[model samples]
Target chain A: MKFLEPGLIALDVEAADGAAAIRAAGQLLVDAGAAESRYIDAMVASFEEKGPYFVLAPQIALPHAKPEDGVKEASVSLVRLREPVVFGHAKNDPVALVFALGASSSEEHITMLRKLTTLLNNPAHVQQLKDAPTPEAIGQLLEATTN
Target chain B: MKIICVCGLGQGTSLILRMNVENVLKDLGVSADVDHMDVSSASGTQADYIITNNELAQSLQGHAAKIVIVNNYFDLEEIKSSLQEVL
Candidate 1:
């Protein structure tokens, strides 16, 4: 699975809350032809229904709904927030990085996540992601780390 | 031991948790059949332990399987310690 495509990343973006963050992140997927426009709202609705489960870790969120919701292909989007937004997660709240995933199948989702597990499970990589200054830096980090 | 990883959609986060849990289990040399499922499918399924996020854990109360709530799906240390409790 491909990481954040060129132009699919937004750095220092502004989001009022988790929903807005999700929308901003999901729009990247839509704009890249990875998902339909409805996929964005579906992700927000999923968050509203499931609470903060989308907040995967501290300062990180993987907002996604089901594939049937509107995903056209498997892709990922990254948004580094200028200001953190609360997702109501007690342990992993006030997210600064939103990773909106669009996977068209469970197999594709797992393949993408397996690579992410290697990237996200490491604290050093997590810190690099948090401290990344630009989208290109984030892209470089992912390229070097995940595979 | 049988383990079930559940999320609302059954595919996204739960699958990530399952992957981490599997790694933790491997590291501990513990053998188990770990499965991932949707919240609705989880109701009918039975396992030695049910691992999920806090919100889904609430709805899974009174289940036959012991419930394990994990705050961060990517935290293997947290997962290992949590599994150590019941295993």
Candidate 2:
């Protein structure tokens, strides 16, 4: 469904809390023409209620909100933190990659999640993603997943 | 027929797990219907079992379905074995 567009990359962010992470990701989504400006609040609220859901996976976070929460399009915003921010999960590791996802519906979004989960489960791929410094590099890494 | 409801906090991951489960079942020649439910709205449903991760499965404490903890929803091998046990 072409959610992660060419412009959905925010190189380095300096977010201290979950709310700040949502703001940074929301801005990227808005800039990418994926979501409206109002989606920032919805994303924040969703995170507040359910948290980042990082689970046992350290250094990675999947930030998403419901479809009815002002999603203009299905898209993903890739954020690399300059430093790590703790989201109070059991893993207690700083988040390096925050993938802000916005989907049109639950079913449609699952396809993307399946692909993303496969990528995340690979330690080598996750390490490459963390080491990638430029947006273009991150795009290349994502492209490799399809191969 | 055995039913397995796959759910996450939102419906996205749950739906993905449901699709994968269905595909795995089809390949195994198993007869079952997999359903997708949001973790928040999964109460009061009747299913043979619930297949989800540890966190989401904990939320379905009062459900009628037997909870089967799936470490990774995309792990076809794990999901297939778990479903076979339940069936």
Candidate 3:
């Protein structure tokens, strides 16, 4: 199933820092009715609590929080920053893409993550996502890559 | 064999790690049950190894399972090399 939608993507957004970047992505989930507003705070706080472990790859940050932390639905959102920001991760920093994910349970999370991991493993695809000019472009890219 | 992928929240990052660890183990022809959980829950869980990042590995220092610190959750080569040494 196609879970990620064009409306879920926010391209070339401006953020002062990593927290704001996360907020930009997380806010999209909230706006999509996938999560409560506080879910965004939980995602931001998770970075502070655990450092940049969520910065899974160079130029990529998958900011997320627990299902119990206000996730109303299982969903993912994308936000590409106009300017990359450092997440303080030793290796992966200056993150350019923020994917804010919210899951109501592990089973639901596993389904979404399988697609996410596959799409992210290819650097070309990552670059495509980064260079995608519009939300529809990003959505089309993800749809084309799904297993 | 059993492995638990852990993180502070035990939801996003750890789940990603768990999937990679499962993949690495499969590549090595090793049969193992992989799980993911929060740090607090990890302390009470039974596992042969607890795969976690460098920072979360600190609080998990005294857990029964051996701690394997992975710096990058997305790097399959890094995950495989680290798991090979201990597994």
DockQ of each: 0.79, 0.25, 0.56
lDDT by residue for model 3 (A1-147), tens:
225688788888999999999999988898888889999999889888778778877888888888888988788899889999998877778899899988668576788988888888677898899788888887788778975
Candidate 1 TM-score, C-alpha based: 0.96
Whole-model lDDT values for every prediction: 0.87, 0.70, 0.85
Which ranges in model 1 have alpha carbons more than 4 Å from their true place?
none
Q: Number of the top candidate by DockQ?
A: 1
- Scanning candidate 1 chain A in windows of ten residues, the lowest lDDT window is A1-10
Give the poorly placed runs of model 3, Cα more than 4 Å off.
Answer: none
Compared with the true structure, what per-residue lDDT tens digits does model 3 show for residues B35-86? 9988899999999999988767888887888889887677789899999999
Question: Among all windows of ten consecutive residues in candidate 3 chain A, which has the lowest summed lDDT?
Answer: A1-10
**Which residue pairs of candidate 3 clash?**
none
TM-score of chain A of each: 0.93, 0.87, 0.94
Question: What are the per-residue Cα lDDT tens digits for candidate 1 across A61-92?
Answer: 99998889898888888898999989898888
Interface RMSD (one decimal) of model 2: 3.9
The total number of steric clashes, by the backbone 3 Å criterion, in model 1 comes to: 0
Q: Kindly report the docking quality category of candidate 3.
A: medium
